[model samples]
Target chain A: MKTLVIVAHPQLADSGTQQFLKTSLQNFSTVTWHVLAPDVDVAAEQALLRRHDRIIFQFPLYWYSAPALLKHWEDEVLTRNFVYGAQHELAHKELGIVVTTGDAKREFVAGGKEDYTMSELLRPYQALAHKAQMSYLPPLPIFQFAYLTDAQKQALLVTYQQYITNSDFTSFHGQELWFEGQLKAKIDQTKGTSKQQLTQILTAVQDNREQLEELRWTLSLIKDNEDE
Target chain B: MKTLVIVAHPQLADSGTQQFLKTSLQNFSTVTWHVLAPDVDVAAEQALLRRHDRIIFQFPLYWYSAPALLKHWEDEVLTRNFVYGAQHELAHKELGIVVTTGDAKREFVAGGKEDYTMSELLRPYQALAHKAQMSYLPPLPIFQFAYLTDAQKQALLVTYQQYITNSDFTSFHGQELWFEGQLKAKIDQTKGTSKQQLTQILTAVQDNREQLEELRWTLSLIKDNEDE
Candidate 1:
């Protein structure tokens, strides 16, 4: 599915999180990065939205909501006729959010510093999705991007890519396939001794994926037998 | 209490509700209508906020949230330190909202056309109030202003004014006192037969107030006797 990442930040040039996300999605052929601005051509933006299957509203959370630029974009591009009118232009499409927060992720919970879940805080978008008849995905919240270790950053990059590309990202099996594709792509670009090591890793990943699939099939078969 | 109404509309001049509200509060010297712009002076805004006992965010609902201009003002004006830092600047101050929607009021409920309550859609503001240690008053939603009957319009005017001025607006006792005060003011400004009519109405209102107070006192006395 084609994904459109509409990023809105007042100081887009200075945000490290936006930079990291931009760099992470460089290899994604089916993804489009759309930066929101003060001036919006509503018709063009609406056309762009129609072209994409999944739309991602990516932003740094300010006051527990997106930056005003995104809101501005929404106000301009999401006219009533286009959103909930009789034609239902955006119906059955998917809506996702990638929110980056300066605060720790752990603090966004009951009795924590924020005293609210991320889900509760991001209800406006869900309400919009509901109104537009779009499928709302669980938000991908990246908290304390500056504090994340290298390993965590790597994991974030993978997850972010999958959020854009993989339809079954919530499952481990889908993630395994995503990782395998990345490994295969890496192997294609590599040569000599390092390529051999990468191929072996790819083979092991494939083995794991096949075993999981087989187990799932066997479990379904057992359930069927029980029903009989 | 001094009320600061920070209004944010992309085209404030065109909004009928803003005009109505502005006309309604003509004689209210304690209420200040501060229109938000793209450029914000954070220190000045915070100082203004500090001066007011109550701060109101007045805007038309854009996609179930405030217009982008309001969010822009919020992002610029409400700095982290000024709101929730060591000083606790806005603590105990009242934060109220004046949200105008073109849709029917009854449509903003569970299973209604809007499918979500106004309270649910406006949680972001409440969350901000919580973070600042401010008291969040119930939002005043003005629905379908164009379609309101003349009587409804008058009621809306009174409610909008009371929301800004009256401390106990949710209680019938509070409304009775408010109407009494309003009637007295009208009586003072009038002459001849009209003044006499207003005075009679005021007297009748006062009598009702006394009766309610007497009933409340008797109920409390009965409770005390029960305790004895």
Candidate 2:
């Protein structure tokens, strides 16, 4: 599937984790990286979105949420007739988020300083996904990136690379596995795990991974193709 | 104090309750109603915000949260160094929300379709307020605006007028009273209530109705002055 990664960091050039992830996607040929600002031309954005099957919003968690420009993009780009109401254009697209958090994951819970789970904090986006009729993937969270040891950061970078490129739902090595487990449990319970069903599930997962990798590769080629 | 109302309605002209509230504010002299949108210029927005002591975000609740644009404004206007970090511009300013909900207040709870309280859904804003060192008031939620009788809406208009003008904090009536009661209980227990304090509380409650009316008048005048 074609993927559009909308990088929404206010100062992406200064970002280590986001910069690293953006650089790593250079090897992939299917993903289309769109570094968006609030002032992006609407027609231009629509064209970029039309080429992608999945739209991934990547940002650093600011005040427990996304930066303002991304919010502006959603407001302006995801217009009424296009994103909601009866004839929404974004109905077929898949929506996901890749966020780097300054705080640890444990700090985003009931008794924690943040006092809300990441899921609960990000529920607004989930609600938006539901309204837009898009399949919402669980967020890819990189917690405490600033404090990570060099080795830990390297490990995180590798995991993040694997996550963005891997389409196989079952083999996702990053934090996305938490969401995958939730999805697996639901599917397993609903379908009743017969041997044939299990095989199909595994195959679908692998296929999804390959599609994701292709998307990454495609995105890297967009700039080169435009130059030519 | 000059109060700024940042109104965020996808279609403000089409909304009945919101339109009425917007109309009522015309009677006040100290209120600045800022109808926010993507088209609004950034420098102009910053200037408007700098002029106001109290910033109130008014919006119809969408899927148990603010619309995308409102979130965008929060992200954009409330910047790191300005709103937080070393230099705090909005420090000491009062931040409030005036939200209109389609569902009843009871429906935003543990067993409801939302499975979360309005307070929980709005935690991100509250967190923003805390981080920015602004006094975060409990949101003024107009539950089931469509279901309200004309008389109820009229009364609400009056109460909302008081809320926006920062007149008597306790005069406006709604389920917010219950929320305030809960807050009061916490406050009462912490500081033993002296007779003078009790008198002050009683006077504040008694003055609410008139204070709200006076506030509306004050805000309307402010709007008129700005228009000229």
Candidate 3:
């Protein structure tokens, strides 16, 4: 699926998180990155949005929200008759937010220092998506980016790519399926033992995914029976 | 208390609600109204915020959020050493939002057309207030301005004034006190049965306020006892 990443950091050149994400996302040929600048052409931005299947609003959280330019882009680009209203252009398309924060992830909980969950604070975007008749994806929140180790950063890069490209990637089961598919595609090009190991790993992942799905179904049945 | 209202509507000139609010708020000598313009001076805006005892961010809700210029104001004016950081300048000051919406008030309830309460959707501003150590006042949501009757518009004008000026206007007792005070001031200027009628109305309002407070206290006591 074609994905669009609209980056909206005022000081993108100076931000380490923006730099990391930019470099990480550059490998995907189906992904297009648009930076929010002062002289952005509204028509071109709307056209770009129409062309993409999944649109990710990537920004650093400023005062528990996105920076100014993103808001500006929303105001200018998402016009009434064009993007919203009776004849909607962005219907069924996915809208996601990838936010980086200076504070720790633990700080974004009910009784934490922030006093509200990230989901609660980011409800406006969800509401916006609802209004536009788009599918609202769960936001990807990266906290304390400056303190992330090399391994953690590399893992985040892979996760970020999955967030953009993977269609059914809202669950661990879906992620495992993607990983298994990736291994299967490469297994044909490998040697005897390597191919065998890859096949074994894929089988293990599939078994784990089935177990998770079964457990989830059992839990839902229990909940339903209790309600009845 | 001196109030500083920072108005941030992109098309303020065309907005009827904004115009009504502007005209209504003009009568208050202690209130200063500042409209956000394109080339806003950062230092001046910060200084303005510092001078006021109560700060109200007034705007029409654009895409379930504030207009872009308000976000720009926050980004530029609220600096590290000034608005936030160790020596935060905005601490203990009242930060209120006076937002106008195109949707109906009933639409902003659980299971309603909007599918979320106004308080839930406007959590970002609350979080911003928490981060700045400012007193987060309950937001005033004026909905469906175009559909409001003349009397409704007049009531909203009085409510808008109270939101900006009254320190404890959220409670019924505070509103009754304000109404009583206003009536008391006008009593000496009148004579005969007109004065008596006003006196009777004030007494009735005060009595209702007292009864409401007592009922609230009783309900809390019952809840506390049940918890015990």
> Best lDDT goes to which candidate?
1
Residue-by-residue lDDT tens digits, candidate 1, A47-120 = 99999999999999999899989999999889888998756889999999999998887888878888788988
Compute DockQ for each candidate against the true complex: 0.73, 0.27, 0.64
The docking category that best describes candidate 1 is medium
**Lowest summed-lDDT stretch of 10 residues in model 2 chain A?**
A170-179
TM-score of predicted structure 2: 0.63
Candidate 3, residues B92-148, lDDT tens digits: the string is 999999999889999898777787888998899998888788999999999999999
Query: Could you tell me the TM-score of candidate 1?
Result: 0.93
Better of 1 and 3 by TM-score: 1
Evaluated at residue B154, the lDDT of candidate 3 is 91
DockQ-based class of model 3:
medium
Candidate 1 ranges beyond 4 A from true positions: A224-228, B223-228
Q: Candidate 1 lDDT (Cα, whole model)?
A: 0.91
- lDDT score of residue A222 within candidate 1: 100
DockQ sort, best first: 1, 3, 2
Q: Of the candidates shown, which would achieve the greatest DockQ relative to the real structure?
A: 1
Weakest ten-residue segment in model 1 chain B by summed lDDT: B79-88
Instruction: Report how far off residue B186 is in candidate 1 (Å).
Output: 2.1
Q: Distance from true position, residue B163, model 2, in Å?
A: 2.7
